[model samples]
Target chain A: MLIKIKWILFVTVFFMMGISEQADPLPSWNNTNTKRNIINYVENAVNEKSPYYIPEEDRIATFDNDGTLVPEKPLIQILFSIEKVKEMAESDKSLLEKQPFKAIVTGDNEYLKTANEDEVISLTLKTLTNISERQLREEVKDFVFKTTYPHLNKTIDKIVYKPQIELIKYLQKNKFKVYICSGGTVDFMRGMSKELYGIDSENVIGSSNKYSYNEATGEMILEPELNSYNDGREKAANIALIIGKAPVISVGNVGAGGDIYMLRYSQNGNKNYKTLQVLINHDDDKREFKYGEKNNISLNWADKYKWNVVSMKNDWKEIF
Target chain B: MLIKIKWILFVTVFFMMGISEQADPLPSWNNTNTKRNIINYVENAVNEKSPYYIPEEDRIATFDNDGTLVPEKPLIQILFSIEKVKEMAESDKSLLEKQPFKAIVTGDNEYLKTANEDEVISLTLKTLTNISERQLREEVKDFVFKTTYPHLNKTIDKIVYKPQIELIKYLQKNKFKVYICSGGTVDFMRGMSKELYGIDSENVIGSSNKYSYNEATGEMILEPELNSYNDGREKAANIALIIGKAPVISVGNVGAGGDIYMLRYSQNGNKNYKTLQVLINHDDDKREFKYGEKNNISLNWADKYKWNVVSMKNDWKEIF
Candidate 1:
């Protein structure tokens, strides 16, 4: 009996020590004042006895995926989608004769870039609709697993910033519900978010295509109809419609239409709602490409609004 | 001297009495329970002295315009946009012969309803592009000022619920910056949001069209290209990009996507943003058309997400 009790005590102590010694996934994060400030703020709000202690229900966090998590210097997703379109065109030679697909296959990036948003959308729809939903999901899964960022030479999924992932885990550990609020396609993101970010499909809100359930077939069918682009204030509306809760914390990189709406929804006065707006400024070029306020409308708006801009150059101690 | 002193005292007493006579905006709100709970939560998060108090830089707020602020029953904007299309088609006889324009000119509500989302969008683009941006803005403005809701018989803008408007004012009074985050067209909302909701053009975030600046002519031209539709998680991105801050509070109605993203963004561990996700559920058939989870995705998502559903059946003492 004495030996058993001693052994139990030793095991407990070892476990506790092991847990304490576990390194943060983002160890490169400098022990800077900014990091300390953020940690302190979280601690205060989470302490139940503290006046600032917020209940778990109010602890909601949102993060943008592009540029914020994954690199988007040369329009990463667009490139990938275009590549997928090319592959589809190659498989089905009929698509090779189409206007947009023809342009794409010929390596006419300039013409594709110059195409209006609607034209590009139409092309995307035509290309994406070539496959069934199940097939598309499988294809996306395969692509995500194998595809690597050309510049980083890392698997696209692995290109996510370690610090941001840590931030997400930390928030989740503190009972804050985290969501990936992105501009990417809803189905596409839904397919990968759980595996990539540990966020469930229901929690991952995004742009959607109109879908219908065929009563006779008893199968969900994707319609070639654009319902609404998840951008700008629509982003806010989608948030309200889907999340059904005002968030206390919001984070994003780009100042596109969606980010603005998220901030508006998060900050608008109502009962029991609080928010922290953060813009992840991409200023690191060594690890990631850097672009600021040249033609990026969202980035320009962030500066003009004097938001709490987190400089990748200064604030973050580590890149992806 | 005695007469003067008496007069002064009487005047002072009268003023004090007058001040006390003023009614509280929300007098029926239970002071020490639900109402106080809300106020305390907001105060704690907003007050800089408190540990939970978010700095002013982080205090972002977003509001949805359609059914949330104005009447959406029958979709007034869609109707107006359709009307504008018809009017334009009158001059452009060629458009009258086109597939979508031909359909619009028929004025068959059933046919229009049967039209797919793509068909509706294509028709709208054709009609809208018939006129210049300036002309389109003027036409929409004129329609808004002149038209009244068929059921309410009140000017469409006046159909705004007085209580919600008061809430907007209340938020502004408390130093919270507000924005109109809607799924409506950005230009259309920008034309009227300032006058109707006291939200500025810069603060209005919504679905948008790609525009071009004619440097040679010194004119900004609206292109027919649809850029991004502001919906779902995109709403969250818009908030972050435009507002450059996360909100401590978010107010939305059924169909507004702002709530989902707002709630998620509000729960950042670093920011400790609190959220009051209020859903303005329309259930009064007498004042406004009742709309909820009957057949709409918004209502369905709201129910599934367990949002703070504010039913018109229970919460509101009055409707516009």
Candidate 2:
């Protein structure tokens, strides 16, 4: 009778605790307005009685990748290209004879800081990476696994913000279709999307390279040309074209005004459901890198639009 | 006691019948090798012990629209553009004065028959369609639900091939990710894909028009210019560039050499799983339209490649 009474008491206590406690959807987030706002928005969205109620199909979320999801300190794609350019220089020798390639090969760091997209494309296509996508994807996967960002000790995949990932999962749990809208090449991002962001390759929209298909071998050769450069206004346009739906929630970081258009596009006042727009303000140099565009256009836009600005120092309890 | 005995016997018989019977996946498809091949391939693919086992991530299946799913006749997109052109001409009066618009508006049947894509673009952009994608998509949905194809009394959505739809659903039931790599406009197709083929807007890859984003309102205005014309060789390239994974199963119809490249692309011998390539042949004039490319390019290629040539007359028990 004593043993049975003890077991009953334990079961009752456990049941009461289970019923009393509401689990945190975003545990990595600190108890700030940024966290509170996100939680409140999601709660209202899933509640049919709430005015902010969003149906499953309308819960579209678009996230910018490079700085928002991972550290973009000088952009990760450029680093990937630079590594390939150096490897090619050892064999070709003629690569060092070119302008952008020469700058990269000779360690002209000052020149590279101001290198244009055309120069970067030339470095990528002319020196390396115009082969079949299957082959290039293998190389990208190898690089991502082996790579460490400058001043960072962790592998590329581990550099993602813990709070942002929690937010993505929270939104997904409420039936949101989350898409990564990045300015990086779609081919490059697709190689790591499944592993890095828990996002499928098809759900990632990015800058694309024109491809040439070989009818005989059925090999898809990545052409030496830009099909679409997914950035700024183009990001929003690509979302409209590919996804064919306006995102109710958008997350981006401050950089070269790259995300302003996409953020503005999301909050464009067409939505029947209440929306959330998160701008990650990289102000914590101790935990993560501290940087923004020199012009401050994106931050200004975020301010003007009243989008939620997440301070890395205040909003996150942990940064991966 | 007699009633109880009868109930027991009935239950035993029903249990025996349920255990003995296996469901037919593609009922619209007659007992042919094509159906057998599809079933066998998917069975082996999902079976972990089989050599053809494909993981969920790698179970990619791509399908073509147009004649593959719905009748391409004069091409449904062209007909849609014609309808818009006619509507605009009625209000403006000046729209009937242009070259291709005049050709369409004046009912110059010969000119329209020979009208190329540029002429079609001129007719579409000049007369109409330089509006927001949201508004344009609404018009497309209205057309799909209300309008009928030429000589077909049914609405556009009702005219989809039942056998193909059955095949798509069968693939889905076996954990395959099915995508529609159509030559239609992505915006136009997104409007009716769910109703017509049970495809989501994001899963339908197609020809795209350049779009301009409205920063103030987030309205994506459909530009008059062509972005990517997803047909022929481009179909295969677009599949690679967008989906980023080689399809293990591809379904397309013979019209031009359009389906040939995509079919070949699917069977490129790069996968671990056994693949299925289906070439739909429109050789039943009595039940449906009978047509093939004049050059016989697609049929000859299918013969050379030894792909499954599904004769519309012999293979299908039903058309729609």
Candidate 3:
């Protein structure tokens, strides 16, 4: 009887050690404060007796797609628009007579660099629409799967920051429903969301064009109208209008003023769960890439709010 | 040994019968094709062996709030809007000088009775905005909880169509995520969705005003601008934009052209799980109200599509 009890204790201890060895949710992340903060937050969030415990229904975590999830110096959506414009110009040469369309088709974006909101919108409509949403999505699908990134020499899907994807899955495993809230078009991001990030189309939120559906064919056609161009304040506002609840974990990067408002929205006066704000800082040009916004607005918000900033060089042990 | 085996078999049969006896999901509906169709669709949807099996992630069900889920003679939202307008006038007598506001203040809606779309929108902006979304939601909450129905002699919450609530719960029991797609403002419906219909705020979708957030306070202030006024074809269009997936089951009513497009949106060329379209016909004037659209558009669509039309008096054995 004594021998059996001792053998049972030995096996249990070995089993626990084996389980812990395989339980690193973010293996790609270095043993830095960034990784520790995320794991600790999730652990406390799922603990029923913890003050930071969030009910499963309220555990929403939103992520910014470009810059945060993948490379954004040349946004994937921008490349998609360029290819679409080139396709349109091939059929109708008159499209090349315009400023932005001509600039895009001829590979000169000097005019686009200084374009105002209205000028940019005109280009978006010319390139992104005058077709059904289904067709636009198909075009994007082809581009993402076929095209290779310039410097990375790999497809966008194969190189979506390994650490971010792991973080999303980790949150999902702990009962958090993750959403992609980006400045990219809804259908544009949706084209690659499922296969790339394991997020379904239903959970992806972004800017979209107003649609007209055919009763006979049931295809939703995109019109030359802006539905909502989400960035900065629109990001938080649209979340209020759509998701109806404030997210508890909001992740973005410090490239621009892209995600400061969303992070603020998540942390603003939230008394339930201890909200987490993660700002990914690109600091490794050797491994991946490095850049910053024109202004220090995003970094300022991160500083004032005491947000966790993950340095790519120090915090990410791997880069896809 | 044979006698003991026979006793065990008898007990097993009795246990199977007890499970079936407790498995009636929709008890408020009388035996009819309406109830039968819903049960059949759910059964096949959840059964993996069936060709009509919808993967759990794709089991989205959207419900139109007015006339479909609850009463709509004097829509709950309309009543709430009127009360807000009145309160606004009482606070600032200057607001009573306008045409619609003046008419409303004097208890004479002569001007509003034939007001055009822009004029109605002007009123919507005035009553629904110039305040934070949170403040407007609080106002709606107060109105829904305190107001009494005119002829029903019961508060709206106390009488929300018991059969419809049962149907919602039944679908939820089978792993369907239900959402409220209503012409009412998202904030307006969100206020009472949980208490009255058992739907969370995040599951409610509706028209909304644009919002601007106060960086200091984090309050999302509603702007006078209309973000998306969802009605007619816009309902389906907005759903496609917001929800990103076409609903397999869409429920609406025939009171007006309020839901024909959404019903069509659900069934249009869907080759997946057998899509179900339900049109609740408010035929019982003694029990509920009776009404129809100006034209036969809704009923004609229902007839052409062979959508299930629930007769409020005949199909419902009970109403809340």
Candidate 4:
């Protein structure tokens, strides 16, 4: 009787171990309709026998960097630009007299905030000029490592949305080649891409400035000339050029105006496989900021196009 | 006594098996100084205890596609251009009267052989125009799959140098991410990169034309605008922009004018690890073409720069 009891306990323990080994791919994601849809889509797409099955080679998933993967309440690039101006101002006092630099130096946040897109681009280019490509990368790496997200009080690498991280892992497990198609500088994103999102430098496509190689000095110098501005329709074009194939799954935050093009491109690919477009909506003001324009655009687009939109407040059980 | 003999035999077999398992990384090459240097470099770079050891993430190896990987006696793009013109002329006889089209249609091989670089580029652009990016890829795939090398009487895919193939595999075994930074179209290279060289699409950087996404038609149209010409110095710049790191090992054919820049860029990276630049020399007239200009250029450059030059006849045991 003692031997039989011990054997029964051993069998129970072994069965439980087997069950635990097959743990959830996305534990942070609540068992909501959004989660169910994603699981079903992945199952049908990856399963060999399914009609909508996609080959492992074609399993490409692209995610927007800023708002989709991590919180971008105060855009990181803007912060970096501000820091660059301040750092430059310490050495060159004449920079304080420049229009955008002057606006930033005088603490005119309102004017800087309402500054035109070209003005912001000019400021970024001005600050980053005369530095080698390697130096620029080092600077970005230092900023990413040293700075902390204002609300989270965690380093830039630590402020990633837990649910999205799980999704990236899940996609990777299913042999999906995950890429970050961000509007951020490719150089900057590449610095922390591996650390923050588990995506490699090769897989990060973003806005870029041209760099020239000086044959005489054997030096690679970064030019202020904008090679690619990876935003809006350009994002889709850049993805096509770089990745060679359109993504099967695209994830973007609703508030990011540039991501819609990439999401549409993903859905527009080969019709043999069922494509997925996930738009993350930050509606939870307590945990995250709720922006009006982007939210309105996302709601209207999702409704009209019948795309999946995850409400942060309702769909998410927790937010980090 | 029988049991003792059996135990001895078992030990002998196990010992032999262990020895066989640690076979040479590159067996196709003859036992030469070049082969030994490559083996030594890989060993030092991969061994953690070695002072020159590089991390797995930073172990990048780049190779030129055309002449370095496979024979380019009949340049691939020229052949592709000829094929495209012939295919297009079937539908529109008017194309036969066009400047480059006439030269191709009349089978004026001498004209094509002596044609300037810009003329060749123009012809290529003309042939590749007016097709969707997907259609262009399918066309190239069809061509690559169907065509055979004249000398070897084997398919183009099977005509790769055995020694180089082994080298690529050996590098991969050492945790090196090998890329094909080709002068060919990125789309065309990507189609064969995986099957031919065991490289994925993302790692195949090449010349490319602009592509526009047509929203109304829901199609991606390949525009005539040249996005990037991934050759010469542009190769190094493209590698920097795309891969975000200089490669540890750079392999190129001495005859290919564009590869020297990429090879230099690879060696110019981090100084902690010993960098390698291998220039393939087509000095064997019996096995391959011995073009005077390219051969001389490679010999001079390799000598001047102290880059390793692997002679086809002397260094390699066998060709494809």
TM-score of every candidate's chain A: 0.82, 0.91, 0.91, 0.90
DockQ of every predicted complex: 0.02, 0.62, 0.68, 0.45
Cα lDDT tens digits for candidate 1, B42-106? 66766778877765545566787777788765565666767866777778778778765576678
Inter-residue clash pairs, candidate 4: none
In model 2 chain B, the worst 10-residue window by lDDT is B112-121
Every model: iRMSD: 15.1, 1.8, 1.3, 1.9
Q: Write down the TM-score of model 2's second chain.
A: 0.91
Q: TM-scores across all candidates?
A: 0.47, 0.92, 0.92, 0.90
- Model 3 spans with C-alpha error above 4 angstroms: A1-18, A21-23, A108-122, A269-271, B1-17, B20-23, B96-99, B102-122, B269-271
Model 1 TM-score, 2 decimals: 0.47
> B181-216, model 3: which lDDT tens digit per residue?
988778888888988888988788887788887768
True contacts kept of each: 0.00, 0.71, 0.67, 0.37
Pick the winner on TM-score between candidates 2 and 4. 2
- Model 3 score (lDDT): 0.82
For model 1, give the RMSD to the true fold.
15.9
Cα lDDT over the full model 4: 0.79
lDDT of 4 by residue, B1-320 (tens): 99999999999999987876555767678889999989899999989999889999889999998779998766666777788889899999998888778888888877655554345456656677667777777777677778876565777877889899999988988899999998887877876788778887777888887778764544567777788888888889898888888888999986647788887787765445679999998888887766545356656877877888898998998888
What's the CA RMSD for each of the models? 15.9, 2.9, 3.8, 3.4
Stretches of candidate 4 off by over 4 Å are: A1-21, A43-53, A111-120, A148-155, A215-219, A294-298, B1-21, B115-120, B148-155, B216-218, B292-297
Q: What's the CA error at residue B232 for candidate 3, in Å?
A: 0.8
lDDT of 3 at B292: 71
